[model samples]
Target: MVRPLYPINAPTYLRLRDQIRADIEGGCWRLGQHLTLNELSAHYSVSNVPVREALLQLQGDGMVDMRMNRGAVVLDVNERFIDEYFDIREALQSMLMTRACQRRGGGVLMQAKVLLGRVDEAMREGKVRQLLEADHALQDAIGHMGDNEPAMAMLASRSRLLEAFRRARLDLLTADLMQLPVQGLAMLLAIEHGDPGSGCEAVRRHVAAMRAYMKKLLKIPEGRSRADASLVNVPTFTRARESTAAMPEASSTEPASPAVASPGPPTVLPLSLPPGRRLDPEGDGSNDNRSTDDGLHPPKR
Candidate 1:
């Protein structure tokens, strides 16, 4: 008799649940396909107990439906469901951006820059998976900057499903890969400059763009307008000058010194896509060495 190989540290049921969920998202099991305990037990070489527990957990996650006659059926991911999922993501991500801007430190800035560099490298190579992974890491780093455990937990709860969907649609994302790094750079700049308003706006724009693109690809109707969207209004941080001006002057006996001139705003690199030039997933190989006005060059192969 052959022995079943279970995970070393984690619970067997949880591991089985994840594997089953992944298979469902990866399109291995079509919608309404029945998952039987006997088949799953033979497939994983595990007994019926763990398989049943995993299926029950998946049913709770809405990935599978338990019925009277049917064992376990893969749930349908409808258009409305996708919209609601993204709505939750947008609100939580906006909150994270606002808090990250408030709590960003030097280390966070450095890490963001490094992650962006990786994104740029991935884009240059036309590697969609690498680009997505790098961008995900960048977002995760920013979320950690906020130091909010509950918010991170909420975001993490749906992370596996999110990743699985993206993985299954890698081909559809190739066309939009060009804009991904640019959007990421914009968010990084906003965070680095301590501009919470821009950071939140960037998050909103990124999510909206992604939702629009995915809807278009899936042929789903745009159900609601931006004005009617159920999104969280994340309060922006006040400017440093405004906050300082609001405080009463300190009473001092010392003589006043001459005012020193403050420096101008730091110059920002222009990272916009060129006008009338659509993003070509296939390289044109024409402007490889071109540099923008702000001294930032396009990613080279």
Candidate 2:
């Protein structure tokens, strides 16, 4: 399983990492695509070292293939990918359910209930991004209950792939996608009932449903242009004697600020950004073919 460095206010690489993950999952980069490191560095207005590091993180998550000749190539989603993802999701979630049920004194129940409230509110308001984050928070609450690092790490990778596709093509996929809170409800019910089977089965059913939905979409031919994502022009990269990261500004008399602890549990999965910029991160995020301005980038041969 791939691990994320503890994000302290999210470093430039981590920030870039999440930004890119969101783009890929949100369908800005399309299903089958690839991008070179120079292309990405120019688009994000950051150095390629962070870009390379971020892509490495994505590679570990099975989100992309880092080829010597091809650089970063996006992997197409299909049935095999769905099955493998669900299989991993099931195993880790079952283990987490077992652990959470064993130790019920960690206030996991109350925390889950609160997160569920947030999920419900996000859905009611039709905020896709907020809803997605809330759903993951509910899952994190459960993982924290279990206190299982390995299970959480593996689960995070499997889920990033799952959620990325779901978020990207949500509207086209279904008229009613209400399973987010339903799954959370099932887990909460199991916790209250002290039965891991119910929660485990709930998650299993959810993954199965997602697989079916993905299969249905795969049958249709999507025509979103991968080449239209041409980004800001950047110069060729040089490998030797690159400058170091800039030091954070500090005051001579002022005391340094203490780190602000995260209010929520550490997210198992982080967001993704894409090299191609056909989809504007600031726009409505529609699936129709379009282009972004200076902030993002994409192009094809």
Model 1 lDDT per residue over 1-301, tens place: 1123566987889888877876766667665578788888888899988988898887776667786645687765556766887798789888888877776633677767777777766554444456667777877777888778788767765555544454444223333445566667767767777778878777776666656545543542322212211111112312222433453443377433422325653223343444544332222224333343211244455
User: Candidate 2, which segments miss by more than 4 Å at Cα?
Assistant: 1-16, 26-28, 45-50, 118-133, 170-183, 219-301
Cα lDDT tens digits, model 2, 1-301, are 1245664777688878777777887776655688788888888998888988898888887788887855598777778887887787777877787778677626767767777777755543444446657777887888778888877777776576666565444222131223565566666666666777766776676556555656755654553211212111112211101211122334667644532334775322111125443222122224323332211112343
Q: Output the number of the TM-score-best candidate.
A: 1
Worst 10 residues of 1 by lDDT: 225-234
Cα-based TM-score, every candidate: 0.65, 0.59
Scored by Cα lDDT, where does model 1 land? 0.60
Clashes of 2: 16
Candidate 1: pairs in clash: none
TM-score of 1: 0.65
lDDT of 1 at 173: 33
Worst 10 residues of 2 by lDDT: 236-245
